[model samples]
Target: MTMIVRDFRPADAEAVAAARRSAFPYLVTTAETVTWEVAGAPAERQYRLLVAEVDGQVVGSSEIGVFHESEEPGLAFANTSVRTDTLGRGVGSALVTAAEEWLAGLGAAKIFAWTVEAPHAVTFAERRGYRRGRSSRVQRLDLTTAALPPLDPHGLPDGVELRTAADFLNDPRPLYEADVECTEDEPDDVPAGRLPYDQWITLTWEHPSLDRELTTVAVVDGTVAAYSVAHTDGRGSYWSGMTGTLRAFRGRGLAKLAKNDALHRARAAGCREAFTGNDGDNQPMLAINKWFGYEPAVTEWRYVRELAA
Candidate 1:
């Protein structure tokens, strides 16, 4: 079967989401979330979605764009996912070629991609001049079967209170501030700069997938100290968007407190499974997830390639 790679269309949202889910079962994506992501992307991101077709059927998908939030300029990304059953048909290669050409046209100096830890996946990336970088583990928890630790509001440190993200709807600047502080310390192969408040408000706070009511925030003395952002598909799957505590509040167990509250709320809301990811070196966050009975499900490695100017 001949393979063709082209820009994604609105009608392909479902197929794209399906392909993504097939490639990464731990993710929670729907047609609506995919559509919203493609349409609501900021101009700076220059986000573009591509799909690979065989006999008119979408067998692979890719998300290509510049790392607009990175502190370094000319950093780009092209994450390609081909249905497991459709692998080795040149679909992934075609998609990567198209994505690289498009990003090179945009003057990207370097491009990054992620691939599963399997040998075939790593070989595909290396053959295309992509070098392996950092690795991250995808974790899953059986919310229905896992023995979740109980939440004790009174046991929290004095002056610390757990609140939902919805509590700051009228004024979310504090949450934004906390997010900025925590993200600065996150482990990543590419450095992510501080996210501007305006952009955060539009891309994160107003995003369709973010479940504000389930997101837990730890407030200390009326100040946001740590938070656990939650995203749900309105079904039974819950994903952790971000869970972090301010530098000053790191050792106080506030991050765990916030995530525990968030996960408990998610389970109480009928969520059956929970998913999260962390860099291999992010031991603190990994330990926290382990405490919640999350088991490592899959692993992915970052790959990078330099683009000719």
Candidate 2:
């Protein structure tokens, strides 16, 4: 069957969402998130969310655009996915090829994408001239029966405290600072230094999916030291957005404390499953998450192809 590439329409939201769910079950997704992403993309992003339809059924999608968050220019991405049951019918290739042609036309000089660590995905990327880069390891926690570590008083030094993100309602700048510090130090080939507060407010704070009250923060001597920002589908699925400790406050188990607090709150709020991603090289965070009873779910690899000539 010939796969026909076309731009997704408003009516195709449900099918696109189903395709995404089939492709990436680990994520907390919905038709609304898919629709919101395409409709609300900023002008500079030059984003295009396309779908591949075969026999009048949407079987694949490609979210292609420049990484607007990055400081560099001409660096674009085309992450394509085919529905689990639809992979061998040329749908995936057609969607990817269409996205590539669109991005190349948009003057994208370098394309970066992420594919699951499955052999077929890795092989497909390599054949298309993409070289492997950084990776994100997805971890899953069985929240229902997790025997969580007790919050030890002695584990934290004196003058330290833990709080939820709600405490920062009046002033979230401290949380913002902590985020900037940790994000700067995060292990990534794409280095985003000193993320601005305005962008943080728009991109992180104002995201439609965040569950601020479930998000936890660690404070030491009246200062924000660490935090775990939580995102939920408002149903049951939960995801950890940013979990890190400030540079001045390492070796204190603050990262674990913050994330644990968030996880506890998440379960209390009726979320039975939790998900988080860590860089392949981040042994410290990996150890921390494993302590929380999170096991490996899948590995996703970032791939890059230089269009710079």
Which candidate has the top score in TM-score? 1
Candidate 2 wrong stretches, greater than 4 Å? 152-157
lDDT of 1: 0.91
Model 2 worst lDDT window (10 residues): 187-196
| Candidate 1 residue spans exceeding 4 A from truth | 153-155
lDDT by residue for model 2 (1-309), tens: 656899979888878888887888888777877887888777777888999999888888999998777767788989887899988788888888888888999988889898999988999999988999999999999888888876675656688788888788788899888888888888876645466687677677767777899999889999898899998886688999989899888898888888988988989899988999999998998999888889999999999998764
Model 1 per-residue lDDT tens digits across residues 1-309: 877888889898989888988888878888888888888889999999999989999888999999999889999999998888998889998999999999999999999999899988988999999998999999999999988888784588899999999999999999998888888888787888888889899888988889999999999998899999999987799999999999888799898899999999999999999999999999999999998899999998999998762
TM-score of each: 0.96, 0.92
Candidate 1's clash total is 0
What shift in Å separates residue 72 of candidate 2 from its native position after superposition? Answer: 3.5
